[model samples]
Target: MTGSFLPYGRHVVDDDDISAVAEVLRGDWLTTGPTVEKFEASLAERVGARFAVACSSGTAGLHMATAVAGLSPGDRAVVPPMTFLATANAVRYQGGDVVFSDVDPQTGLLNIDGVQDIVDRARNGIRAVLPVHLAGQTVDMPSLARLAKKAGFVVIEDACHALGTEYLDGNEVVSVGSCRHSTMAVFSFHPVKTIAMGEGGAVTTNDPDVYRKLLEFRNHGMTREANQFQNRDMALDSDAEPNPWYYEMPSIGFNYRASDIHCALAHSQLKKLNSFIARRRELAARYDEQLQYLSPILLPPLRIEGCNPAWHLYAVRIDFKASGMTRKQVMVRLREAGIGSQVHYIPVHLQPYYRRLYGESSLPGATAYYAATLSLPLFPSMSDGDVGRVVDTLAHCLGMN
Candidate 1:
């Protein structure tokens, strides 16, 4: 606890990551170049997806996915209220409406029942379901996929917290982001994620058309393919054709491409993703074992029979009444002890903007989660002593001897 202030989450950069970025900086291209393509390919291979498109951020990936899926004004996308605002904001970015769903009270993951309720109640325009994998836990994708099919909606997984998580089927661990159960999956490469790349994201899809549209959308709707262009005769019509630079903009898009520098860093981080996930799980186990006797705090729910979490966050629920201290007070006490603690989310539905949009009402599960949740420091770089200090400080604050 004496070294320095601990953060709830932090990036772990190595010499290789720095060298990779330096190499990219020295190269000719910086944006939308070979390094970006290599990173996309690497991610697709790693996730077992047919295609992967790199973007400026996780929100950008979500927006592109929604737009490409034909979400537009008056349409609705179902989203869990327990996630970050971006999950719902992406829907609004495409002029689509957001219908808030509740989360599981214990896991803070999207409640399948709430999602089904929203789907059944939709009068007309609901088009997609964006289920978030909160805190790096994998959602029940197979079951959700069945619901999506029955409800006639596209499934776009907001997998920002679950890059290394897997969906288990008995003894087999099926990798997430493989799009095995959804139309597409989105991931964030923010500094706090399993693999850090400063600021970037990607979309993984098995559909080729969706992949092509994502590529075009991420790059201002510009396409280099002559075959796909509207006017084929444009190539033959000009003498100085500018090396077939002639392209078409069928839809208005954004310049949301990730830079080569970030891609290089992300590539290096991806190489160590497995080990990072392993370490996170190990730390989570330590917390579970040590904190079991603390009546004031509740650990995150364990994995179901067919799920393996990436453990991107080590969130615990604090019972203020039992602990004799509110969440904020506990957080302050922990900070005084030189440990960093924070809340994972303030349910999106309760945010100022959403309050205006949806109005304040009873969201029992999400509100409950918001009131109790706290994220402790968790990262691969944390040593055993660091873990001990965090647990000890928390125990002291909670009066758990």
Candidate 2:
């Protein structure tokens, strides 16, 4: 049984998902259709956002937020170091500078002090902040939002890892993508995420004007609404009769539309999101209990109060100095034993692109976290027995005698 390779993450599709896609295949439209609107409305309601815009990918959604938030040339965004490159790269897509913020060394979540550090160090005009919910855990968004408001910069959440994840807002529990504490929040529907849509994403916002901008940008900065037209060519006669095909393209835009087929499948998957989060939490708890005896590896679970994390990945830290083994050696042995594992991240500031752009800088918190972080397999499809096998195999590979 231990010889069966288990991946760190995967999609858990069912017959309903297939049927939904099949129905879409037999329908009239494939790209922009009724299903897309339905999916956006359902998702917006689920996360308590006033509006939602489905897009081709999470990166596109982030770019939409940056564009709608007015990030342009000579603007900067402060982002955490421990995250996927997209979190920072999205700013650059809109011609904005990225300022690196260090995370808490143990939890890998950015904090208020880190924001202060960014303010003190950045020589450019910092206009926005992107707080990443790394490894399915949320930053203190309520506090962070307050800080942003006081500092006069907009906040956008990189909630790609936190779909069903929720946190306390005083007496009420709010979902990460609610946009309750930020200008907007982004979500991904990749197979490895909390929910899968094959390939899709969305941005959620409460601001009507921002939502309108998102709508225009996602579909090539064009609008079919007659009232929104800016050209006299749109008028047919002195009667001011509008052309049914009249549309305006005031600014350059890209094709970032999410197809109806993807939306149909994602809508089906969204129905199971609660159960998926429940199972992931169960697996995470099992790992927490079973791995307590394993030395030199620190397990990170629901460390914060009032956080119901969807647990997109179960990342822990291995103390290589005490284990007397290299990180590469342990990973090799685990792979040989059919137990797959991966590093959650390398410091974003240390990446060659960022390094070349900003030169070298010290970030002790991000460095320490990267030196020890490792992600173990934890998916909704994983059985308790499978988790036991993984723990036993990992123990054996580490030679925990």
Candidate 3:
């Protein structure tokens, strides 16, 4: 085992990025200014979406999107079980119920049939279907869209893991954020994501109404348009107008806006997104080639026929019974050998809060994944030597030789 520690994921920051944030800080406006708009425009252009709305974090973006979708009390949203709790928590933020769906055992993404089952069985004000692209793999959006259309469910993609992924359609590959099949797609720019911005996120949509709602929702339901307000000139007509200090709080909303500094960093990071994704794919390929002979560990599932993954995570399943070691034992041994190993998630439904709120019955597929899965180090910044060290450390921990 190597003496150096290998982490599962890390941000690749450069001097240029630091300079960009520094420049933003030196400017006049620090919050919700010109840089924020520029960052939104850049994100929209890159993702092929007509409009992008920046926010404080991925969870904030999700909440804003769900709000724009008109989810209210008594509404229900369908979500996959094999994802971070935020995916489901965003629904609860709007006082809506979350109906959990099972994931594909191999890819850890939502199963189309499982979604269909949930939509078919939904009753009492089911409003939207939130399909999470787990581990940066593209979900079957086309089929899911069709299902949503037939079932009268609004489709909101929790695309935090799939910023640069593309969906397969025979010979054609469509990007996930094009909103090609869903109403709105959300992305994160956290330190561990494909694009790191310290803390930020955005919502992408082609629908003008949804875009307008998101814009208003993110900024505390206040509109800057003079024409929309009853009193156009608040300062000038203070004595004549009913409420001269005038800004209509048309609807209840939250302050979930991103700062110009974070946006600046995200814009800089966006420039290297393609390169980062390429490197991630390269690393995944190396793992596949080297681990092919290791029967005790199952590598991540292959990309769908025409889909391209961003490769945010490289999770492997261990056959603990066959390997004569438990998953816990393997993880402990790997950490002791100076390799950083972690689990992506413990299915949303299995969490203490979810179990208390939704009842703690085991989801066979999600539980199976949680039991055997371990995320290995796979980031763009890793060197070939680092990759080798990770693989060798795992082999030693698993007692492969």
Candidate 4:
């Protein structure tokens, strides 16, 4: 195992997953069928949400959620610069402006004060506040929701890294996709995520109207349900029964539906979420214990109270400058040792497209956090010995003991 290359993240698929997909492959329905509905229901129940809408990708879920939230031209949404570009781009996709907010230097999560400042200064046209649960850690959603309520904006969570993540809400523990604190929450099922669906995502919400809109937005703004159709004459048959072939497109939307094949695999993976999370927690703890003494070169993720992260990525901060090498140099050396590493993100505000669109803005925390962070190998299939080997190799590569 030591001689084999270890990736920063990978999916763990068993025979059961293959069997589930194979069953779907052998069935009649492959896209937009009963399997998709079953998967949606299971996800909704698991997350304590009233409705769950499955989509093709997390980015698609974000776009649909924003569309349903009424984001429009000239509208602004507060986005932290420390997350993936999709989080911010989703707003732009709706022709809305992205108001970049600074994140906590230590945790790469949005703080209430920073977000509040952005909202206050923007005054009018602030349509939504998107708080990303970076690295599987939940944000202070209760506080963010309160701020959104006060400012008359919606709160949609970009929870791509936090499918199984949980946090305390008052006296009760709630799952990340519950949508109890935010208006809607989104999740990703990429191969590297907590579960694998090849490429899938979902949005969870309790509002009935939003739920209906999400379904419409996922399928080209079209609906087969006669009750929702605007053209009643065309939708109903001669006997007043709904026309079986009738479908209406009321608004512009995208083809973002996840196929039945993907749903079957996702449903199977959902059954083993608890086990996957447990294994990840064990690996994270091992890393925490073993990497404690590598001072001046590394700092493990902060142990936040009241939050149980799903451990999507064991991202650690490394002082490459103090370690006498550039980040690229450190990564190259680690790769030479048959170990893979990655940077979780390079602050979105610093990206070329954003700079050309919004101009440069000062966000020191995001910049500092981006310069030091690194994601090491962490997945459910990795052994305890793998964690030890990663730490040992990292230390050796950095010229530390």
Order the candidate numbers by lDDT, best to worst: 4, 2, 1, 3
Quote each prediction's TM-score: 0.96, 0.97, 0.94, 0.98
RMSD of each: 1.8, 1.5, 2.3, 1.1
Q: Tens-digit lDDT track for model 4 on 178-211?
A: 9988889999999999999999999999999999
List where candidate 3 sits over 4 angstroms from the true fold. Answer: 230-245
lDDT-wise, the better of 1 and 4 is: 4
lDDT of 2 by residue, 1-401 (tens): 35568999989999999999999999898998899999999999999999999999998998888998889988989999899888889899888888888888887888678897677666764799999998888999999887787778999999999998999989999999999999999999999998888888999999988998899999999877677777866545467878766788877677899999999989999999999999999999999898898854545543677788899999878788777888899889888878788887888898999999999978888998889888999889888998998888777767783
Candidate 2 segments whose C-alpha is farther than 4 A from its true place: 1-3, 120-124, 235-238
Worst 10 residues of 2 by lDDT: 295-304
Off by over 4 Å in 1: 170-172, 233-235, 238-243
Estimate, for each residue in 1-401, the C-alpha lDDT of model 1 and write its tens digit: 45678899999999999999999899998987999999999999998999999999998999899989989999999888888889999999988888988887777888888888877778994699998898888767878888988888999999999998887755666788999889999999999899998999999999999998999999898887766777656644456343545778877899999999999999999999999999999998888887777753656545555678898888988787777888878889888878898887888888888889879867788887878889999999998788888887888888887
For every model shown, the clashing-pair count is: 0, 0, 0, 0
Superposition TM-score, candidate 2 onto the true structure? 0.97
Residue 397 of model 3, lDDT score: 74
Say which candidate scores most in TM-score.
4
